[model samples]
Target: MQVLLRGDWRQRLRLISGLILFAFATTHFLNHALALFDLQAMYEVQQWRWIVTRSWPGTIILAAALVTHIVLALDKLSDRATLRLPAWEFIQLALGLAIPFLLLPHIVNTRFARDIFGVNDTYLYELARLWPDSAVLQSTLLLLVWIHGCMGIHFWLRLYAPYRKFQPLLLLIAIAIPIAALGGFMVGGRAVAQMIADPKTFDEVKQLSHWPSPDNADRLAAMRLIVRLVFAAMLTAALGLLVWPAIQRRYWPHFIINYVGAGSANCTFGPTLLEISRMNGIPHASVCGGRARCSTCRVRVEEGIDAVPPATFPEAVTLASIGAPQNVRLACQVRPRGPMTVTRLLRPSTASPADVDEAERGSEGIEKPLAAFVLDLRDFTRLSQKKMPHDIVFMLNEVFAAAGSAIAVHDGWIDKFIGDGLLAVFGEKHGIEIGCRQALRAARDIDLALDHINAKMEAEFGRPLRVGIGIEAGPLLMGRIGYGPNVDMTVIGSAVNVASRLEAVAKEKGAQVVISHEVARLAGWTPAPELLSKVDIRGVSEPLEIVAIPRGRDLPASLLASIEDVDERVVGRAAF
Candidate 1:
């Protein structure tokens, strides 16, 4: 058997249980859709529902998921340091707890009423009761459950590229399902109402409304009372959890926690710095939610540093890796033993590229594998020597605009601009193969786009501009570099170095686009090569065999197409 630690097991449990619940909801909604046909069709579908859901295997899974999910939720609440949460998160929590309350009566009257009281459970019966209530409760229940589940799914799968790509389609489906289900109910209810109103069908419709015996009514009343009492007890337990935090705050030693700079808040100890920041409506950044996975929430203890708690092992490791100073402590991990002044290190403003006040703020540095494309103007440096600075700047912007558009169409992004060239990366958000293909696509587009730029600039400069691109694939560190206002996204590794060196050698090799063997192999690219030669690249212990294209526009017609149809191969190349 495979062994799992505490965190692993808990995550697995939550994921498995959540999936089971979601499956049940999906089947339930599909059954609701059958009502649009007629009562007979709906009840027939309900039989299938019972076969799948009430069967021993399905019943065990459903019951286990319900218990496990609740236990985990309560466990998380009990262990929580503060009541602070993002609005969506808080809403999801509230909706999750209220679901059983709103659904319990409906469940009892349908399933239990049928099984125990000999009452018929059918689409007409449910819609007849629901139609009179204007479907207010049913609609509310459906919307609440759907919204909560969607939010959970988004949080779970947003990191995966496929999920993010299909999110729009998923959202449309989410919206349409409930609308169709509820609309079908309304339609079916109207049809039944019309039938009942006709004098000929009036008695038959009345007979369909099966009434429970007096004994059954008494039992139902007692069951409802028990449900209410149990629900009340659950609410009481949750209340106790909330009150316990306050009780501890009152009795425990008190210390004032101060937030400095923007989004400031003041709160008492009996909570972590992250706790006070979130609970007091301060926008603190905790990507891992105070899990010590990152140093994002680190605060510089400007004064009374010693008064703060010492660094835990996780905090120390994270801080050291990011070169944090001795005075800096992770806000999430720190629990002040005495009054301490601190500031949130990471805010949404710092994380955003569009913030007006902090527009220059760059993303934190992280290492990742990326496809690097370094393209250099063949003669722009020499051309700029004779031209005015503003003219050169304008010309370069025109060139970049064309090249940038080409890269963008294929999901590539410019990391930085060199003096007469640009460094771009692909697969920052996509997989490795896609990134390589994107680089090739960009190469072709860039060559074609240069003609447009040259057409605009030739009259002023008396010459056409040409560019050489080198595409290489390898492991690399990508992140915003530099301190203060000098920060910009940069790629650093053999991939970038090799691509840059290749650009430097393009003119000598009589090529406009050069690709490392590694890139060609990974992208499943194979063009009938004019020549394949081992060439010495800078910073490489061994010379690399590279494939050269005389011009980007002259790339093989099947370059991108082959990436999809061709099987993968291995062709290693040395670095720059």
Candidate 2:
């Protein structure tokens, strides 16, 4: 049973019901808005209700929807403790529960008794029972129902960007509609009472009880039973929708992979994975639905790479942003198109797969020296703001793609992308000398890649693209952090910060690439005479020597010669 709930179709059904309930509330509000007009307008609402109620299908639908919504809500409530809910959310839940209970008596008194049993009571008869004496309870129930519904709509609309802009207006409308309708109902009640006191005006209230009288007791009982059964089914479905996924977690515990095509994979049945993990007492992160929207469920396909399907649309979008390799896929999206083997790259939620994979491969040795490189796009903020959203996305995609490919080709691992910049780490398991050499070579490769990207963009957009890069060498701590399902692999220390600062200096000096004196020393290379300079970096008290490569130029022996003279003077100054 739990397994059935975890299935995608069941979840989809629940989503559809939720949408239906939202629609019902919207239309109900619109009907109540009629109160802003006159008593005749309120009468017209009753006529509309009569039309809907008389229709067999409409009656069945409404009954079922109400029952389903209540059941699902109650099921969710049972899953979590009341004490765990925030005070406001708990209050809302209480109000929602009260709505059906309070509404049941009123519905029976007005619609059911009159329409089904030939009670022949006017609208005024029901209004008089609740006015003034029962006013507080009536008003409270109305307010609770309205507020609960409006809040649900608010939450739903928040999920989409287009609706966000009109949120304030939507809220105002939600509040105002209920207030006006309740006020009008109260005023109409008073008007009806006044008319009843006078025999001459009694005839005016006669038409208010216009519902056709039922023919027999048997027919009436059948109608009532049908209504109850319909509502019961709807309520059961809603409750099942909310509760089944949890039940699945308790029972089903195996990971099932479905294959789609060649070189592509998706992580379907992740809820089952989560459930199995929990049953075996293994930790997993799925704060949201196990959807590919969040990259928390990332994994690396270790074997059968050729049998996996290409990335689906959502998976591709997220992977492209993070610069994930072809072999890496989010566990939520990698549905196996054919037979495949995969390892959970992200052992924990917070950790990136690349770092975890590296650690598992025994690439993190104590003696291994790493070189860090940072590449920042110059004038990205101003440029991005001036371009259209799609254009900005396209440009960033091209830049990151080229930069990431170049780093990977040179045997480097990208640590992170910092806004409009890229941070690549080299030699997590290699010697200091080799790390520095690879870092320098990667820098040159990135510069060349950018040139290719710029040429392509120049032809398309009639403008050149620009970026600045910096490289530095130093010892660092590298490992994984976090417990169980939420772990992350990253490097930390002063060396990382210095490398980032060097990138900043490169941007300020109008250079495409900058190398710190330490990196140059490790490389055993002299900078060109005109390519070396000293610049004061923020957070550093003294100026440091830097070798700059101008934009649209290739690194050469002359540039290395200038770096040597600049390095000598800076080292002497530091010694003094």
Candidate 3:
């Protein structure tokens, strides 16, 4: 009983309800587009109205489904509010809530009036009466409906692979359809007004066309046939798309059971887990409609771990980064080939412990000496602009991989990648001296990696890649900020700013690697007599002692000469 309400059931309910609402909106909009065919398509409109609004069972179901959907949405929104979502998310929710409020009058006037009061007005009569006095209200309602529906569809497609592929095209069509429909309404309304004002000239001008009349028997029959065929085709396609995946599982047989515990149930497996949980009733969290993207439906495999297949790449990456235990897995991502006992790890009020720990750590901190390394790839923007997007991505992957490998090999934590630059922190978990040594080793390794990359690029693209690196050791404060899921783990202090300035100086001096005297002292490395120089860095009250590092034994003798010229130029600039 706990298993059913725990995760999968909630997600499935949200997905089914969302899709039903989407289908309802689509059909309703398409029906409005009928105005494009004729100014007085009252017969077709009336037929739709009778079938959907007049039938007792259909009306009841529509009301019930809408009420349920709204209630569920409000519940979800309240949960998100507790998490303190961004301003944009809140704005979107506000707009979505406004939709039903704006729509209530139209629904009550048209459907409720006809069903409860037996005021079976023609489509033209209803449109004419509603358009003049309620134009502003009607326009506002239409805009709200279209925006809310599109936002829902956008979020839904983002979770599904098939829909994701056609997102751009779907967005274009979604935007254009509403424009075309609104334009047709305006044109059709004007045409109808002209016909009513001068009925003598317009021979076909008629009042209150009724559906299922003897005069329109053939048209009504054709309309019913088309509607039925369309509904059948949609139903068939939807079923095939959804059900076929499960049926194919018979041969491929990918079944996974996850256990989520609220203290009492002994971990169990199989279809019975879902069935029993639903029968007994238990509360679970599955906010993303059971899609694998939302990891809310996660469980910890407590026993029979070998029964589950290995985690997929995305699942593994997400889990490992968040430092989840080996047994922890998203229920939607895992599929069991055999029986497995699982325990639910999360509750409505709590997230993963590791995530909570990181969030807490990010907020509390103090200034301490840390080693910083910065690397900037020269002329990368121009290089990227010349290459195709796919090729550019390949190049960037290679570059980042090489740089990251160097940093990791020297025991540094990659702080962040800034476009074509790399920033890393050394000895984050160790003392300042060790951190300085690690940063220096990382710089040497990066030079070696760059040489290899340049050689390969020269051989392949007939061009070399150049980069500048800088290392510094100083005191800095590191912490985390931001709200909810969007928190940033960040470092702050004069040390960071100084490290960046040194990197900029490396570029100006045309040197491969530069180190501040502070870093050299911290690492217990004596500055080479010929390589030492003093320069006034921007924003610093005192001039800093700097050293330029040469690449390997193959260093050009003229490198020292170039450094001398740069030093003289800096002095000249300072004098001026």
Q: What TM-score fits each model?
A: 0.67, 0.43, 0.41
Residue by residue across 1-576, what tens digits does model 2's lDDT show?
211122234334544565665566556555545645766776667667657754788677766776666766665554431123333455766777667655655556555777666555444555555667777777776787778776555433343445667878887887787777677667766776776768655554444544333454355456556655655575566556546755664464433342222122233332333333333333334322343434455656666677566776666765554556788676555544445555553554433323323433322223245788888877787777667889988999898998888778656788878888888887664556556666776677667787788877776655677888888777767755443333456666656788889888877778887888878777767777788888877666788788887752466543333334545755787899
Give the per-residue Cα lDDT of candidate 1 at 295: 51
The models' CA-based lDDT, in order, is 0.71, 0.61, 0.60
Q: Which of the predicted structures, 2 or 3, would earn the higher TM-score when compared with the native?
A: 2
Kindly report which residue stretches of model 3 are placed more than 4 angstroms away from their true locations once superposed.
1-11, 40-57, 77-83, 197-323, 326-576
Rank all candidate structures by their lDDT, best first, as comma-separated numbers.
Answer: 1, 2, 3
Clash pairs for candidate 1? 538-576
User: Candidate 2: misplaced stretches above 4 Å?
Assistant: 1-11, 71-93, 119-126, 197-576
- Best model number under TM-score: 1
What is the TM-score of candidate 1? 0.67
Cα lDDT of model 1 by residue, 1-576, tens digit:
111111235556876787888878877776777777666787788887888787889878887897788667666666566767766567877887777676666667777787787677677666665674647888787877777787767655542346667888998998888887777777777777776668667556546757566788788768877776786687677668867877777667666666665434555565677776776776776544454545556676766687777787667766665566688777777777777777555553332212211111223455676799998887776788889999998988898889999888887878888888899999776667768877988999888888888788888888888888888888887655553223445678888999998887777887998888878776766756555667899798999888888888776666666433433322232221
Query: Which is better, 1 or 2, measured by TM-score?
Result: 1
